[model samples]
Target chain A: MDQITLYTWIGFSVFLVLMLVVGYLSSKKMKSIRDFATGGGTLGPYVLGFSFAATYLSAATFLGYPGWSYEWGLSNLWLFLAIIAGGPIGVLMVAKKVRKLNNGQKSLSLPDWLGDFYKSDILRVGTGLILLFNIFYIAAQFVAGAKIFEYLLGMSYTSGLLLIALIVVIYVYAGGALADIYTDAVQAFIMAIAGIGIFISGIVIFWKGGISDTFAGISHELAAQNENLVAVFNPESLHFYSIGAVIGAIVIQWAFASAPHLFNKVLGLKNEQDLGKMIATYVVVAALSVLVLFGGLYSRAALGDTASAADLALMDYIIWAFPAIVVALFGVVILAAAMSTTDGIFVSISTVFANDIFLKFLVKRNIVKVSDEKAEKIAFQISRLTVPFIGLLALLIVIRPPEYMGDVMWIGISGIAAGTMGPILQAVYAKRKAPARAAELSMFVGLGSYLFLYFTGIIPSTMSAGAVSVFIGIATINIASWILRSASSSEMGAAEEGGS
Target chain B: INEMLSIWLYGFIIALIIIGFSLWKWYF
Candidate 1:
């Protein structure tokens, strides 16, 4: 084959081997579910930082974002800038207290942490079910990865999906949380390098133009068609969603640091010593996010008008705009971004199922008779084995993707945000003793209100249904807890940190 | 590169200010 193709395959093979080695090496420490789930609290700041950023970006950020930039023009760049809000949210809001509470708790999963925080299994299960919607989103990420492989490497989508599933399942099952974090760090570096490489190449390619030039061209083209391209909130333009979408985006992004999976990195932190460095890592990664986002705008300006297919502008930039070698390298980065995330999702889900469902449900009810040692072994075994099960489900769902899958994910995330954000934020931030029932009520009411308003179209056109759910969720928590915690101090326990 | 870096720097500066204020509230 061609030299570029040959080199790319070699590079891809090397990356795959490196991932396997990281997982295998980290597996040496995998004596139990702690290593499998939370790195036994050993991850350093840089690794956790990179891993968190990489996991957050996903294949969707790389693939779908440029298409948005292509269609919408410069105003879309604001959304990417909005992503940096995660840094402060991670440090001030989530990480410090999460790390503080986690001290001596030996908590391994989000469910365990939240359950213990509120001392409610009902809350645990409810939140766990809500988080399972993440599986659908993760499944979508896998589909996007398979599509990327199909686009770049000329692989059949079916073969790519199967191969991707097998690889993620293998490494993640073996490495557990340690494997996911380590491999994610490596994947983050690959993404950052590829992001910059693609950005610079986009600028140099065919001397097409800068951000200002691109917007000017868009204005020129639009003017000829009796339209404008760069307004902040253009409802009439097919090129842009309403300005309200940006508000919705900012809310979603600002809350993004609270995604329980992303919070997995916080749980993985070793101690308070690494906190500042970890936060700094997030800042650096956030800076890089701005750069990569700029690249999206660049690609739109450079190649928007000529491409027959608007959505594939990114792929075209790599293929026609850059050299074959750049294409091959970027191809590896794209697939790496996709696969590494699958590995993290796999470990997270497996941890939830084995620790949250199997152990919490079965052992607590005395459905299984086993020693603590035997129980830990069973959970570890379950965590590893559940990978194939999730893989199978995702594969099946992908094959016959629901018509409303995108909307389903949107509603599910809003429901989850409504249900969990209020409770979790209250648990961490508020000192007042909200009753356990407060968490349960808030989750259900939040989700219920979001779904009710959205399905009934009662939500105002100007307002976000998700934000409304959030407001309702917070109000539910405050009102319910105020009522419950007042005369029920015995049940509430009134303890801020550990179990009273 | 300068522009991208500046935006991030300013954004992070704002982040740090908020973080600083929050920490003060938590401790003081």
Candidate 2:
């Protein structure tokens, strides 16, 4: 084998072994469903914080988004800005509230929280079902890992996909949430190092005189290729062609904090007091990670026409800029980025299936009867079984591989964000008990509108469709709630008048 | 030097401020 491949194999083997060891150790502590789902809410700020940030900065952010910046130039910075601001905003708005609601409870999943909050089984089950859309998002992560493996290790896409799936499933199944959090924290550190390395490398490559000069040089080079490339809102681009589109991108991304895998990190915190530190850590790490976007502009200016496909732009730059050993190590970092998010997502899907659907809904309804202890054991077993099931489902979707990894992931993201954003915001912040009917309507309208717009090509940009649907969802909830409240009051008044 | 690049810089700076303020508010 070549030196790069040999180093990569060694790095990957070591990383995988460390992860499996953590999983084995964590499994020993997994006595209850709570332990499996939320690490029994004993995780400190650093672990929860790093795991949250790592899950947020997925392969899509590290790999796919840079490719976008390479293709569209500075316009992609709008999305980055949204991400930098949105994450903290989402946490500020909801993290404390979620922790308060879940305090002293047996680790509530997002769906379970919603169900209990609204007192509606339908809402919980609906939310759980909507979260399943993450299967596609997980598939996108597989595609990204496979792409890197194909480029660096000369592995076939299918081989890489299966390999990643097997490794992720083994760890997640063994240790559940504890294993996921521990490994994700480690992965987050690796990602932070890689992000800093890539960002510094880009600056060093284009260091004409200083930062401004570097950007000027990149702008000049890109402008020479195509004037539109240097423009803030590339008229030719689908994602950020206008101010409206940029706003749409921001709106949708802001709601991305509501994603189950990302937001549920709050439930893992040791206490509500740790929330501030956790959010602070997450913001710092996420900000650092986003600097990697600069690699896109660097690659575009430096490689020019010889740059590889857009999705591979950053990878190409890494290979060209670094020595073989460094490149091999970066291969592991990229895998960390991919698997970190995928593993969190796997735990989430399994938890929802076992905790929300099977135990809460079915057993509570007596459709599946057992003693309480037996039910908990059954839920734990079912959660473990779900890891491979989801891995297999996601693997099937990615076998063909989509044209753009970002788009494939966005398909699921837009749907989930659209469906849950309104309800979650209302549930967390509303003064009164948020009407269940209103949440139900919001979810249906939000998800339905997004699917209609996405599949029918009505909006042309998934971000725009997602944003519009989120607005519709929020509107539907407010309007439906007001109408219901008024009607109920009127009915009460009439009955009182008749009784008098 | 490009207008778009300048806008991006400003936006990034503003984003940093927003994030900093958020952290301050949450902590204090």
Best by DockQ: 2
lDDT of 1 at A490: 62
**Weakest 10 consecutive residues of candidate 1 chain A by summed lDDT:** A401-410
User: Which stretches of candidate 2 lie above 4 Å from their native place?
Assistant: A25-47, A104-107, A176-178, A258-274, A369-381, A494-500
TM-score of chain A of each: 0.81, 0.90
Please give the lDDT score at residue A275 for candidate 1.
61
Q: In model 1, which runs have C-alpha deviations exceeding 4 angstroms?
A: A1-7, A21-44, A174-180, A205-229, A234-244, A259-274, A305-311, A367-381, A400-415, A451-465, A485-500, B1-28
Tens digit of lDDT per residue, candidate 1, span A255-297?
5566443565676555554665666676566556545654545
Q: Is the docking of candidate 1 incorrect, acceptable, medium or high quality?
A: incorrect
lDDT of each: 0.63, 0.78
Pick the lDDT winner: 2
DockQ metric for all predictions: 0.18, 0.63
Lowest lDDT 10-residue stretch of candidate 2 chain A: A491-500
Q: By TM-score, who's the top model here?
A: 2
